[model samples]
Target chain A: MLYTFSEVLEKVNNEVKDLKFERKPYSLFEPIEYILEIGGKRVRPVLATMAYNLYKADIEKTIPIALAIEIFHNFTLLHDDLMDRADKRRGKPTVHIKWNDNTAVLSGDAMLIEAYREIAKSPKEALPEILNLFTDTATEICCGQQLDMEFEQRLNVTTDEYLEMIRLKTAVLLACSLKCGAMAANAPESDADALYDFGINIGLAFQLMDDLLDVYGDPATFGKRIGGDILCNKKTYLQITALKSPETGKEMQDWINKEVFDEQEKIDAVTGLYNKLNLKGLSEEMIESYYQKGLSCLNKVQVDDNRKRELRNLAESLLTRKS
Target chain B: MLYTFSEVLEKVNNEVKDLKFERKPYSLFEPIEYILEIGGKRVRPVLATMAYNLYKADIEKTIPIALAIEIFHNFTLLHDDLMDRADKRRGKPTVHIKWNDNTAVLSGDAMLIEAYREIAKSPKEALPEILNLFTDTATEICCGQQLDMEFEQRLNVTTDEYLEMIRLKTAVLLACSLKCGAMAANAPESDADALYDFGINIGLAFQLMDDLLDVYGDPATFGKRIGGDILCNKKTYLQITALKSPETGKEMQDWINKEVFDEQEKIDAVTGLYNKLNLKGLSEEMIESYYQKGLSCLNKVQVDDNRKRELRNLAESLLTRKS
Candidate 1:
């Protein structure tokens, strides 16, 4: 009765599509519907659902929590896009651009509320725990985002600091999503903790892979300009490592301090320095370490290895994903 | 053993003061502490505590819910000030003015998560109902704000439409505050419903009085400058009524459409037209009606009259206060 990755993904998509934003104050609800409709991979909710499928066959009971995670993820994206002043998300105009800043702020707030309402629909016995976990995860994400913003202004950010920031900003919700699903299935507490740990490692690896793909992936497959992070001087793991290395630190700083430069030249220069440092090999090593650590945690779960197949495949796919 | 209104207010204030924002990423939490520190009347929490006091002697048990309401209210104000492009709140610089818009948005979001975290600390039996009530109320407030913003660009907003907007934007939180306290106290559902009704009516009256005072209160007592709303062409209850009136509609439109004029002259002319139309009297009647309706609902609560005294006093003070 275990749902495969695509099956869980389909289930999550169906639930999101079924949500009606037909409330009054169409301005507030329309953006929510718009963002939800212009969907991404549904990664968070699918993670939640697949995690649930690891322990229980009653996938129907997990839909609300799954949708909650998805909606919450979208809420964060909506606000983050506004904060970053980015013009697009998933290749479509962001809410602030589509409507206005006020609409983005208000609708984003409502979406957070909507996420909580969905979480509250959990079985009464599990509501309190799920609610607490979700809130704590949410708070961490905010702090993570704050740190990410703060790091943007500084040049001395360490690799550890960057990892911690991504952990808070990105990984914890992934952890929470997995743990919530396990909890909903009445999984043993130890098993749930194991799943949470699995999520954290995989999430860290997942984000690292994103950073890696931004620099190394083919443009036709990456779905974005490959040198975006480089052109913007984003302090990803590779950049942080390159900046910390004595061999490349001086040159990296010179490049970052440039008032203006040709975009391709800067990208090429940074890419060349990263190559000299063998940053690609190092980042891959880090990614592989976390990916293996995630597998170890998954191995500790009390569930049979067969039941863990889809989740295993997901982690593998994420590590190897080109886009 | 029921706590007095002042006692509850003191408790709520003390709890707010004691909340530590010492977590990492001080930039994210500092603004949260800053907004909470500047403070307000603590109305929502006080209402919650007093409502709890009516049914139980254990006011300590209600502190988490009370603080939750207070923090949530401040969070809304933080974002609202940003959206309104407001420079000041309560005679002090707002969070956005003090920090930045991104800070305001992120910190406001964090405050919301903080509120839910506090609410989760409520007695487990009451958590579900309170969380649902809170989520619903939060969504309504967002809708209310959206409508308020939408109404700004239109010239034909009806009295009912305006009332509905205020009810959603301003009144529901008040209602939710009272009901949450009652729920925490394990009040009977019927009694809780009555308290909610009382909150709604009084909240409507409270907002109406704010609109009235903006136009008619003594400058010495109103704290804020009178006719500021008029100067900005804010669509308050008085302006909406004036717009709907045959006697004053044309002149009001003339004044509203003028692109250039003295601020005081515009205020005076608007005040004169309001006087000629008796908007002051009409607004007062509307406030009085809501106040009476509130009292009637309070009367339906099964609590002894003696236990209702502080709440009754608070409501009366709200109706009569100039500022």
Candidate 2:
């Protein structure tokens, strides 16, 4: 019942799947390949194919579009790694760390241009609409990133504000992926719009769950340490919601204001307080609400129940992921 | 003839011009706008258009193609400034210097993506060949830049070796612009091939003149201090040719072997030696030879005398520039 239906999407993914770097004279290609092969979940492309699958029988027709989304996503990560001065991503050396900032910057630029090349090759019939949607979504993502960067500097960022930022930066691309897929499959316009909304709600839920996992999940399951977000003082839903809470708000701020006791200690104490105040349960409830919204949007689509069931099951599987 | 016949080239350059950076959030766009507004001669676009015009009358319709070339050129410059730690370009501060490296990098990526967007928008008639040419040219430009960076480290770069390096680093894009324009115009394959060769030879000549002017041109016309290349110990044609000449060869090698020298004294002494060996005269002869070769290539293109003559006049004008 899982959507193994997108064999073409799988082929497209595999076409680019870990293609060899094939080093050139004075090559900048290798480090970029290193970063790309470091093993991401390939979420954007998957979403694109899944979304497209809901609308059309010919999923392979949208492979180039899916490739565009994947490449664009990778380009962002390459540049972001440089800005973050991050040393590792997915247990492999960051491009900038492995090569240098200059290589990372230029290779990332090349990768981005490559994404456009992929878009340009899409079936001409769907070109204009898909290009517009992709461009618009890319812009929104950039805006989201800017806010995320700005958030690190602000002394005040409300939970609602963080939600808006993530919705722009991360959710829109996910939504656009589905919309693009639908457009490619020549699905009814109404169905495409509904699918877009559904993807957005699912995306929002996914990010909120990510926020929850940072605080409460086990390290072995998450593949990264839990409470790492608190150590970095990131403005997540748990922290922002806890800060705005009436009962223990000021004390939490006081604890945050401290020249941060031990990093792990700060994370553990705050996480413990989140448990005491039932913040985790509250975040979980909010996540569930969004999931329901997603399911409702899914129900609004006119697809057969079996296919619809598969999609719902897929979304559920996403939520059930331990990592 | 118009003194700068390159205008014919400029007018036709757009056939292959790809512009329109993929939109990023408004926050990342400010620096891109700031950088693009700083003026340049846009010589590469002109060369592309001019070379392309020689083959087809409909070249004007290829504006998107030319825009692509211009945007990609600027994209490289933006990233190069960051790598060079350069603070200014065309009398304005660089993107990275004006904003921050993060912004410059992200914006530059956006700009590169935009170049492809413009390419993708090419009239369907002009797409397949245009994209292939653009991709090959763009990749070559990257390879050239990598070589330029690599040259900074090696000590024994010879005359032939240095020619090959600059031919790639500076001249290939100019040549590519011309070739791309030809592709856009859907000129006879024969014309495209000849113009490509002419562009390559003309580029070699133009770069030689630039190297010559760097040491010997009048200050008012040249816009920057002459001999800056010599001061930086850049391996240029003059040094290479002088080192290859029997009389001055060993002395030139000795001069280059020293890691540091007084700037004014070194410039004056080197210029004196180059004159004594008649190295500038040799360089002028070689430049003329390539120019002649370029003219011969232009002769092979079956075009109207008026248009061909205009391109010829443009090449001649470049030879005479004091700058």
Candidate 3:
């Protein structure tokens, strides 16, 4: 009855593929289909299902809700790509690049509405709680994005602020996904709350690991252009850690302050400075701390240890993934 | 103890001013405040409270739901300005113009989430129906917008297609507002359904009047640039009617197909052609038909005539307004 993580992911994928978007408004719906077809890890939905499976064996019951999470995530990405002026996603042109800003904006709004429609399809008793949690999570994600844009204009982003930003922008939805899944199974409040906390920790660790991988991972396996964060001067954990370091802080500041330089040179210079400050070690330690916290939170959930094995395995796999 | 329409508007205005948006993230929250401050007529919320007052006199209980409708309307405008690339709204700079495009997009998304949060605060008994109606209406609005965008590219749109577009884009929210207000009062489903139909009729007439005003209304009273819709070649009811008319369809097509001309001359030429086709009479007749239908729907509500007076008066005032 309990499905493996990969099995859940396949269900998520199939559900996504079966999503109904009319082709008449080709300009509007095309971008939606295009973005969904080029998939991410479907991680949020997978986590939601995994959490649900911990309580109930009916994976089918939660598939729509999981799809809702996936659609909502992609909706955010559609708008984010415009804000970030990102040209590529999933090795394909970003929605805005493929269509235009207006198409991306309108299509993304439609996707959000579609997400809510999906959420509204939950069993009547669970509908109110799910809607409340989902709306709050959505608001927080927007706040996180605004903070991200704000940080881009500032030079003095503290590590704490960075963590909070990523937590809102990236982590809360994951937490919400897991919590909502538990709720879909009619799990007890205590267990749901514990799963939420576990998700927050795992999400934080996952994002911190992402920050590390951006700089250190191999280009082929990373599936993205390496050194992009450095080139764009994104305030990742490494950059913040290096900026706060007593040893290499001054040199990192010099590189950040340099007005004129080749792009690759700047990336290399920042990488060298980060290495000198041993930021990779600092990042790993930070991620490990969150991962351990996540494990402890998982321990707090009252489910049998055997029931939690897949969730634990999924979290570990995500934390240790190459791409 | 029932409030008059003006009293409801005053309450709506006060409630909007009292909304709590955190000031720290000025870039995000400021745009929201800016747009809400440059307020429109607050028509949707006003309609909501009127419908609520029809059943119950407890105006205070419904204020939050009313505020939610108001916020949602402004949210649409924020993004609509971006999609239309309009520079002004309500005689001031639009959100995108006042700040920037990214600010408008992000802040609009935040406002939408805030709307849902407001909806979630409804009395627990009303929350589910309210959310279901709200989400469905929101999706209709988006679909209507996409249809509008699609219409912009084609010249062969029929009158039925145009009406459907306006119904989705403009009418449904008003309908939802009234129905939601009635639901908040625990009104009978029959009464709520009647109010929704009344709103749809009123909304269609209102938008049709808007189209008429764009060409013929006095600029000073209209509070916006006259003939602006004609300038942009927006496919309004009058334009579509003229295009389909056998009498002057050719001349109308010529004016529409013209590549370059003085703005005022184009306006004059279109106005001349419309006069030749007697479009003003046709549009007035159309408005009158919808207005009459709206009144009939209002008459169908089982509430006593005295209880229905404020709504009827409000409808008459709107139908005859110069602006």
Candidate 4:
């Protein structure tokens, strides 16, 4: 029996909520509970399940793998929140802000271990491949984060470098999710590889859309302050592309170099420069290219088109998200 | 042919040095290199190799397991240094101090993934069991560290609580090391269990000895300042025991509550109280009890006495260590 995307999401959420975290060490487990409770889209697990259902309708066996990806995602966010010194996550105070840095660090470490415990629960035959893939993904994600940090300290980050960073930091995990689900279902190597590629392209397009929305999305719908990237001088795709354009590059650089500019004014000037350079149109074209590439990869999978409708819908929903 | 202890250490060192870490992200790997270079005793890996040799002389097959435990040990230290906000490790600046806290956190995370990478390299037959053991040990260590941190903020930590924390934080990894090596060797489960128990007891004794030396040993030999633990008011077994005693508990409480007390005066007073209570003797007795338990566990292992000589010697060296 094929399940809809919402059904798959509900199953994943139930499994997550049912996890019996110990309550003795309130400092460690409390923050974990807080983060997991204030959930995201559960996109990774949903993707994993949707990929599995396309081959094997038995979602029971894939829940651990799904949970593993979810836990690992939260673990990374816990640390990323600390590294970014973020005050809020999903509209609540971050683990570090609510507790302290040490609590955040140690709790995050435990959560990483918890992620592995879930990964290990995969059927023995699939364990080695999944573990290897997960390890590589984990290492690449770290590299991606390091690159992101490195970029933050630099004034001139190339578009190429930024894309690679996001690919590592964001796309590989999505790819790993699909590939892992396929592996759990004992899908053929070719199909699994195709799903991975499909995920990577979709992930890239999804991130590109996120960059675009941060600037142009309506404030009431986006659930975040507009032009935050511009205010922080974050070297996102639009910023990098605008800075790379010869016509407006110098002016954009001058705006970025201003030491004591008002925050709102800086956001306005940068957004204005972005508009003048028509970066939004360029970014849309780039996103569409990746979206098409992703669809091609999905088409290459041997599964019938009908079986892929849920995954396709998910990709579309993510790309079109206003928040 | 079976290798001696130093030979095993040298083999592990060569394998570690031969590992080709990426240099592009110097911030992540550089701190890892720096910490590994300022080496500890490599006790965990050496114990692992010795346990493997006791059953199977093919040390070649165990190199990856050895390296895995060593890397995991170093990874813990990297984060532990940051959590404790310690300035120096082994007479050199910590990763956080040398690079920064974020560097320490991310690099430690990468090293942990690297440890799993090494563990995955274990012979296929031993991989799952070793991974399960490693994961459990890793989680327990985190729990232990959390307990330690929690205890730091409280004044009424019990001796049993302190023992359990140290066992989790310190002993379990040692036990895991020996048990993993035995599993790799396909040693009898009974013998493997005995070796694990032996490691736990030895590890407890080792930590107890460390606490004793921190108060009584010569600074030159200890490689750290005497009375430093007392100065920081760390709730070691010594402090916990003294605080629990009816005869001196009141005086100990008063001394601990002194907000602006002179550091030297506090240290002198604490040392005087410990001497009055003969805590040094009580601690030595506790160490001997654990050491004896460890030896008894070793005796229970089915391996020939000659096959056990190196492990016995290593245990003795650790027990008698001044630093």
Candidate 5:
């Protein structure tokens, strides 16, 4: 399973690495290359390939769709950095930070178009379905981004709203990857839809765990600072769910409404309260429930038992991991 | 000529206003309507219709193609505003400023895809050809945008370099508009290619005139501040060509190097120097030269002389515009 995942990651990195030349002899391309090169876990593309392999082991055929997924993912990261005003991505300077906002936007635009071009490379008969899925996925991701922006200034947002936002913003693209890969491999529509469900469920679980880890995980091993979301006052799943907790709702609102506080003190207070509320455990349980549902979706697909076993095992490995 | 131009503008505006809602929710549709309402001249799309009218008078058939051009144009503007950190576009706040950077980028992304879908609406015989031209135009627009960015800080650019940049940035899409229109109307390939040259030349001429008007036009008529390019230190044709003159080179460099000056005073001084070097007249002469070349291209097309007269009259009208 590790080798299979690595195989998909390799192609994703390759496609993302060989972006168009940095025309005009400037270092603007550096930040773009920087964010893409600094490395992600390649989870989306891996799900695409693994999902395809669940029905058919055509790794070669699935590579391009996986590559498309990865490109689209990175493209989002580029623009999201601007929205987040994030200076660093993956421990490296972001596209907008390193280059001016203009270059960042242009390069991101180019990357997105390239993603579609890559997706359109599938065989003619296979293309319309995959293209339709890719188009729908892109729009869903946009809607997710819009919702994420809406979450920022809207204090009335509920946990369900946050969940939907994350699903659109993060999960749908991951699902599209799997769906595209299966469609490319000529899987039946039912199997492709099942794969989509499986990927989207995992993606939701993955984001849920991310919200948990941001507050509860060991910073050294987590590859991010504990409570980074609290530091930024980002509207994440844990924050929303914790705020939505009937008993804690009023107090949490008071904390969030405070305009001025010591930075570290705010982080400390938020982290302490989140832990006291058992939100981490709640997150863990909910994430596992989604994973179980995802596994059931996989099992329901009409594929060979061995293939199903491999997929079920892979999902377990991802869901149960700490890092 | 004015009647034809107004007729085209009105029809394009009406057709563009008539977008069918394939997706739910009005907010998703707002950006497109917002941009169209900002009231551009519909220059590219009109060029498309005019070019098609040259070979075939059934110009109604090209509406989808023309709308595709408009969509692509707005997509560029949306993303460009994000890149430029521009606050207002045509007296309204930019998409990024009004909504958020993520919405701007995503809306722009969706606009580009929708443009492709619209382009794909041509007859099947024209579909592949239009896609090819659209893709090529899309690539050129990116390259052109990259060059425009490159020109910002670049000091050694000559008139030829500036022309090349504008040709790609402003002209290619215009050329693509005409070419796509011709293809959609099933005009002869030679007529399409010739019309492409005409549109490209005319587009370049129009951008040059815009540069001229930026410094010289009445604020009310121009709908914005005069000398905006000078204020921004834009390396436009006037500035670049003025700098290219051996005598004005030193004076141009001085003004450019000046870190501080009163806005009106600085604009006056630069305008004075450009006048002294006759850069405006030079630009005027160059514009006329291209207009002639455009007309010459129009002449070479094998279409009936009477039908060709419509495009030629439009060119003449654009040549004589005051604002």
Candidate 6:
């Protein structure tokens, strides 16, 4: 009776589409609808739903959790976009741009409250654990964002620091989503812990893939301009690894230190240095290691292998995604 | 034994002082500590604790709820200050000014999560109801803020609309604080509902008193400069009411429409218009009406009159306070 990955994704999409925002003060709710409509992959909620389906056939129970995670994710994006001063997301103007910074701030706050409201709808017995996990994850994301901002000011951010930042900023929510789903289904503690571990590793590898694709992804397939991380001197895994190289470290620093240069030229130069240093291979090896570790954790979940097939498929697809 | 209002206030203040922010990254937690340390009345938590004390002698059990309401209130202020571009709160530079806008945004978010985490520590049986109330109130506050912002751009706001805005923005949290405490103490639902009513009326009156103080109070006694609302052309009840006056409505619009005027001169002229229109008397009548209504709600609470004494005193002090 378990749904496949795409089936759960469709369910989540429909639920998101069906979300009612009839509240007054339309300004507050309109931006919420706008951000939800201009959607991303819906990965967190789908993972949550799929994780819940692994333990129970009745997926209806997890709908609120799914919406909660999706809404919470979008809330973070709304505020983060404002903080990053990002103009567009999903090929449309971001909330702050579409509305205003104050709207983004207030709407994002409401979205977080809405997320809590949705999550609280879980079966009463499971509420406390799920709420605690979600809150802890939320706090960690804020810490991760702070670290990411701090890193932007310093030149010597190490690889470990970068990995830790991504772990908090990007990985923990993915892990929490799965754990919340498992808890909602009344899964055994051991199995839930294993699923959480699986999520963490997959999430780490997922972010590493994002870093790799920014420099090496095919421009046509990547869906964003290639080498954007380079032009911005973002402290990605590839960049951090390249900076550690004895052979090309100086050249990487020189490119980063350029006060004025053509954007494409800088991208080309730093990317060439990455190619010379074989950073692409190093990053791929790291990603493979994390992916393997993730699979090993999945092996410990104690579910029949067939029941895990969709989750495993989803993880593999994430590893190989082009855009 | 029930703790007196001042005793509960002391406990709440001590708990706030004892809050630790040892977590990294310090950048995120530091501003939270800063905002908390620059204290206000701690009114919401004190109200919660006092409401809980009305039924149960175990005020200790309400600490988490008290802290939750207090932290949530501070979180609102942090974001509200940023949204309003307010530079000072409690006579200190605001989070956005002392740190930066991004820090204010992220740190405010963290405070909110922290608030939920604390609230979840309530006795398990009471957690769900308290959380639901908190979340709804939080959403309403955001809606209220949106309305407030929207009103700033328009001049035709009605008095009823103005009342609704303050009820959402300022009053509900007070009401929620009381109801949460009542729920935590396992009071009869009737008494809890009555306390909420009392809170709403008192909160409305509290805000009206604030509006009255802004224009007519002794300048030396009012902590802020008198006539701040007038100078900013804020759409408070006083302004909205004056806009409705037939005799002086035209003059009121002129002052508001003026592109240039001496600040003191504008304050003086507006004060004169308000005097001629009897706005001060009208506003005081509204405040007295709400205060009386609040007392009647308090009268319905099943608790002994003795248990209600301190809460009544607090309301009286709030009504008469200049600053």
Q: Any residue pairs clashing in model 3, and if so which?
A: none
lDDT of 6 by residue, A51-149 (tens): 999989899899999999999999999999999999989789999998889999999999999999998898799999999999999999999999999
Model 1 chain B lDDT-worst window of ten: B2-11
> Which tens-of-lDDT digit does each residue in A17-40 have in candidate 3?
998787445667788899999989
Position B38, candidate 4: lDDT: 89
Give per-residue CA lDDT, model 3, range B167-270, as digits (tens): 99999999999999999999989989989999999999999999999999988898777898888899998899888888868887888888998999989988
lDDT of 3 at A207: 93
Write the number of the candidate with greater lDDT, choosing between 1 and 2. Answer: 1
Q: Please, what are the lDDT tens digits per residue for candidate 1 over residues B1-323?
A: 97888888888889999998788888899999998999888899999999999999989999999999989999989999999999999899999999999999999999999999999988899988999999999989998888988888988999999999999989999999999999999999999999999999999999999988998999998989899999878889888878889889988888888999998999999999999888888888999999999999999999899999999999999999978
Kindly report which residue stretches of model 4 are placed more than 4 angstroms away from their true locations once superposed.
A259-262, B259-264
Q: CAPRI verdict on model 2?
A: acceptable
lDDT of each: 0.92, 0.75, 0.88, 0.90, 0.78, 0.92
Tell me the spans in candidate 5 whose CA falls farther than 4 Å from its real position: A1-3, A18-30, A50-63, A258-272, A308-310, B1-8, B20-29, B49-62, B85-87, B96-110, B116-132, B183-192, B216-226, B258-269, B298-306
Instruction: Evaluate residue B267 in candidate 4 and report its C-alpha lDDT on the 0 to 100 scale.
Output: 85
| Candidate 6, position A248, lDDT | 83
C-alpha TM-score for every candidate? 0.99, 0.86, 0.95, 0.97, 0.88, 0.99
The regions of model 2 sitting more than 4 angstroms off are: A1-13, A52-62, A127-132, A243-260, A272-278, A300-302, A308-310, B1-26, B47-60, B158-164, B239-260, B270-278
Worst 10 residues of 3 chain A by lDDT: A20-29
lDDT of 5 by residue, B7-51 (tens): 887889899878754563346557867887787878788888877
Model 3 residue A314 CA deviation (Å) reads 1.0
- Docking class for model 1 is high
Which fraction of the native contacts appears in each prediction?
0.95, 0.26, 0.66, 0.74, 0.26, 0.97
Over 4 Å off, model 1: none
Sort candidate 5 into its docking category: acceptable
Q: List clashing residue pairs in candidate 5.
A: none
Angstrom error at residue A200, model 1: 0.7
